[model samples]
Target: MNGPKKEIPLCEVCQQPANQICGGCKLVYYCSKAHQKLGWREGHKFKCCAFKVQYSETFGRHMVATRDIKQGEMILKEKPAVMGPRMSGPAHCLSCGKKLEPMKIKEIYDFYKCTSCNWPMCGPECEKADIHKAECKIMTDRKYKCTIKYEQPDKTEAAYCVIAPLRALLMKDSNPQQYENIMALESHLEDRINTPLYVILKANLVTFIIQVLGLPFDEDSILKVASIYDTNAFDVRCLDGSKRLRAIYVTASMMNHNCKPNTRHIYLGDNYNLAVIATVPISKGEMITLTYTQTLLGTLDRSKLLKINKCFECVCERCRDPTEFGTYIGSIYCSICNGPFGNGIEKRPMLISSNPLDETATWKCEKCDHFILSRQMFWGNNALSQELMKIRKDGPEKFEEFIEKYSQTLHPNNHLVLQAKLALLQIYGNYKGYTLSELPDHLLKRKLDLCHELLELADQLEPGWSRFRGTILLDLQAAMVVQTKRDYEAEKITKEGVQDELMESMVLLQEAANILRVEPEMRPTLEAKIEELTRFLQTPE
Candidate 1:
């Protein structure tokens, strides 16, 4: 007998034995033209990629760079497999996820509603939008009218919770391939069950999908969908920033979390296509990473957030270092070494966690050898953060007071002080009465110093082509330009000195423009700034 017939590869979507392979990658198999389209939209278009998926015991499924990737090089771009409103939110258009304005009493009757489903939508076009069509049919078939009134447009609506889960459930029959892709994502159901959000989802979402909508899904299955969403969905801000929605991208979600991620992603256009780009040069075979938490957060806070939200403790290089790569953004200045209790020495001993990964770890002063409970440190930081939130709206004076008051107790580069300074950076030049032209020479210098300090911290913490760095670069360039002109007017600098400063500001602006190149909303503004700066620099002295 001939050797057993060679086993055929299975379709990626349906898993049926298949002969057709993707012509581009020749790596993935599809059963039909329809499934091919689905596969491409799901991720294969980008998966013929600079990276390849790999599995390990530590990182179950993650992407790895297949070849060297330069800074700002696009790694992957794919449309969201599923997108819908957040768990709870204000009234929003069912079609586009835009916040819906409250309809006045007279206009309520004429307000745009899906002709079939009677659900409020943005307009006639949205009434026929594909995203809303499936769910609208289900609600209409079940005779469930949306009772969400126009009153209290900003108040969080409990009824809005059902839309996303309902959409995911509808996928079971409406689109089996997408349903399979979504269900295959990490759910963390075991970890999520009986948690506060889990309980709320179960009581509100699960019950409604089963009893109210009359969907034939069990509580566990429904909650599993919610768990998948909670674990994997990206919080997408609408183009106008008026509303936030959630979307799941199968390939993008697989990258493991790192404190200092090698990659940055931006959502593009109305369809929310995501483009993941390398923030720094990535070597071949390196595992791809994306930060699930804010880069400005300290090690302890980062660990806490990752543990709670992503279901893992990050022991990355940054988290493992007590000094956080010497930035010491998380550490408190030791009172005996740097505070009033000391002899005013230049020594900068700091209190840092003995075990960064352990929540109950003791914090020991590097010089004084004094130890404090991690809980105590946590409470202290929490209180300070609360105070920071309160004074954030009070403008520059409050921020100055906050920085001065904590400078002795906290490390100079402490995350809280950095946050206060970042706030001041925006307020100093943009706020009324604090505009760049109105800003005094001393305050201008202060702003320049703040930019330098924060940019240095950003380089260490969130380095290279990052949105955070891009924003700071914009602020820095603006401050430099204003200060240079002020110095020129006051005769503090010569014409050549002015030329040198303007040239430096031009470089800063170009860097900012390059960094924000992939951002659609920022492109026009950046382009305008670049043109204006180029003209100024080229003009005669």
Candidate 2:
């Protein structure tokens, strides 16, 4: 005989008796469809995950794989617990987060105005967007009108700073669970107390919330909210791709940092729901990681940025290795040690940091033991970066000149040289006067070579389905098509040869399409290109 039947499960929303289990996870019960939908919108979508949260002294709270996860597998999808404008940027539409255009003298009051809070909004639909409702009421109730006039509309406004924090504070009463999630994040407030940004926030945001708006919150509490935003928020691109806004994801933010993280993320749809996808395979129990800085940056710059922004010194394998996993992206060539042809006895010894973790560490030549001051190297790279910026808009000629000038002193794969090559690659096929059909054979070959070099480095450093690699693959396939057509026109190859060459190009195109599959904005264009390429490949030569 069986024991007493298991008690009926309760609804997640109403806590009443429930028999219906969630189809996605099969763990939670809902009394009705309405309650189930409400539960998902509240939190279950994030809670249903293939990974689990774990704690460590090194990473604090971080996500770990619960099972062996395959590359390109969707690991987690979550909506932002809170979303708002970045602390500093041009005043944007409060509803859609799109940058507001400079208004004409007559159209300003009629079109761009939000009737509820007197804030800037794009249209009637945006003014009524649910995201703006809570903050709109607060502004209206307090009689605090937006003072931003149409005059000087292009200028960055400090007034925009209060919107995000205000929304977060309001969430304390309206959405306690989300407020708790925000509070659970590490703020590093003690370390940030005396910083210049903190001081500015205190004067502007804290004062406005307490004295001006009459909110029932103290200074530290408000500053903690700002600090939480600083530490955990992700830059979510607006739907139109015009600008980026700050959003705080509860579970997604818990992933720890790695220089070569195993996962990449994309914002899905207009809702800004984040989907974290594994870029590489992971064993069960392995820690899930994401890069906080650009993978293309050298160890010094990446480390410095992480320290300043995230308040943690990353000692990841890539950061500790001065050679940066043998790519030597940050190294300088030792011209004195190697002859012009390079000493044939051994590979050219590049100058690498003695201790990459220490900013003041000396960079010594591996072959001759010649040393240079770290400060000198730092400032030298900065100067070169500034020069590169100045000439970047001057076209491919300037890029080639910059690469040639720096090749003698810097390693071939140095970040600055790579930047110039990347710039040239973009220009060779896409820019006017340098289109693929217009490019000389020599220039076309240069573009192909740059694509190959960058892809090789990307595989080593970033690896898997990275957007950077996807873009390079797209360029590579286009160059291949152009080269093949040019060769066929020159009678350098037969119909069979042309088909063979294009088959290889098709493989690259397919891979690029796969990599960009999750990117909603890029997906349609890629699909159209794929269809076009398929038709061309199928046609007789």
Candidate 3:
């Protein structure tokens, strides 16, 4: 009898049998020098095959600076070890994570249920893709058809949830070593099993994985796979034209959390790799961090989310400081002048803590001696929040009304106001009837002001080269360039004035481009804008 069949690693580029070996490191195989060169250009060269994926006692399995790593350095770039549609999300194709229009997929892409298994896939290419094959083979062997559809009470996710965990189980056999690596990662099963989702998981996932798919694993072990996904899965963003695809990274997941993170990551669409870059200098042996929670939220909100999701209370310097390191993203507007209540006061009260942390905290106006209870402060915030929520349904008229009404008592930089401003900014251009060309000079100025305000607040709250700042800066630059062009055409300014304006706008655009160029999807548009501005700037002043 033949011994166990030798495994052949496929070429990364063309997904073909690769007999030729990579000379740099023997970890990969390539079909030819041409494909090898293509793979290297696409970032296989930085795979860190020689470096050991080390473990730490303090932070668990984390990647460290073996030597001194500099700011803006690509610390890690990795394709997802396993990726699929997110739990509680809409229906999507299992292979590519794109939204599944079942009929459209069937008609246009020739997507069909596998002849053996009856699971959906775009074509033979996607049918045989690594993402689908293992799980597909197992499901087909067991004669499992996805009985669930888009209209179920779970709204497509009930059946979809099984795909990732099933992939985990299948990986145990097809790729045992990789399965071990994933198993070695933290699960936080004990923490997650206590949540409400577990009740549903028990009712659906447990039954399906054991009974429907006919896996031999015990209930506890199966749930462990789910908890691992809950605790560690990172949102992979839009990839392969798929919305909100989440992935598990063997190396990147090793990084811990920090409120004011020193590192930032960009998703490269070319090969589905995430590139982690240093936003600030990282010293040797320092634990690398990624903000698992949204940095845009205020301190109490951030803490609450972290506690609820990740099962830990953060004590980072940002969390410890009641004022959120002086950004005051959580602060209320001064009830009188709408200034930030503690403008210059040393003993200013700003959100000591939220529920479960503290019942209440004082909110005293240091300058004006206006006393508002902690409960009272949040009450006001809640009222503002309720009104802000209506803007989505009530439309632009309501947004302007809400802003004007709140401006009387709330600071422009108040979180609620910022939320409204952000909403309004998005609407002013992209929304129907509010096109940029249709906007008057004063309206353009208003849009410009909103961008500036948001950017200033972003600098204070979400600092460094952030997506929020980059997006707003691009909007600001675009608006300024349009306004400048209008001014020049109407003879409102001299050639020198137009040149000066273009120069100023170019600075902002360049900064926006630099911050955004790392993202593959964001690069082309920003590059085009930068080129347009550069051409305008070169014309005689």
- Predicted structure with the largest lDDT when compared to the true one: 2
TM values, all candidates? 0.89, 0.89, 0.79
Q: Please provide, for model 1 over 377-417, each residue's C-alpha lDDT reduced to its tens digit, 9 standing for 90 to 100.
A: 89999999999999856469999999999877888788898
Q: Name the runs in model 1 displaced over 4 angstroms.
A: 1-47, 107-120, 150-153, 392-394
TM-score of 1: 0.89
Model 3: per-residue lDDT, tens digit, 1-541? 8899998789878879989876544567788899998899899877633223467665556655544556566677788777776775655667776665554443453235555566555556666776777777777777777643434322545567777877887777778888888887788888878689887888888898788778888888788888888778887766345556678888888777888887788777634688887766667666667798877666656766787777777777777766665666777645543445434444333333333244255665534656567667667767777777756643466777777886556545667767777877877766667778878777788899999888877766667776777889989988888899898899999999999999999999888887777877787898799888899999833
List model 2 lDDT by residue over 182-237, tens digit each: 99899999989899989998999999999878999999999999989989999888
lDDT on C-alpha atoms for all candidate structures: 0.85, 0.87, 0.72
Clashing pairs in 2: none
Pick by TM-score: 1 or 3, better one: 1
Q: What order do candidates take by lDDT, descending?
A: 2, 1, 3
Residue 26 alpha-carbon offset, candidate 2, angstroms: 12
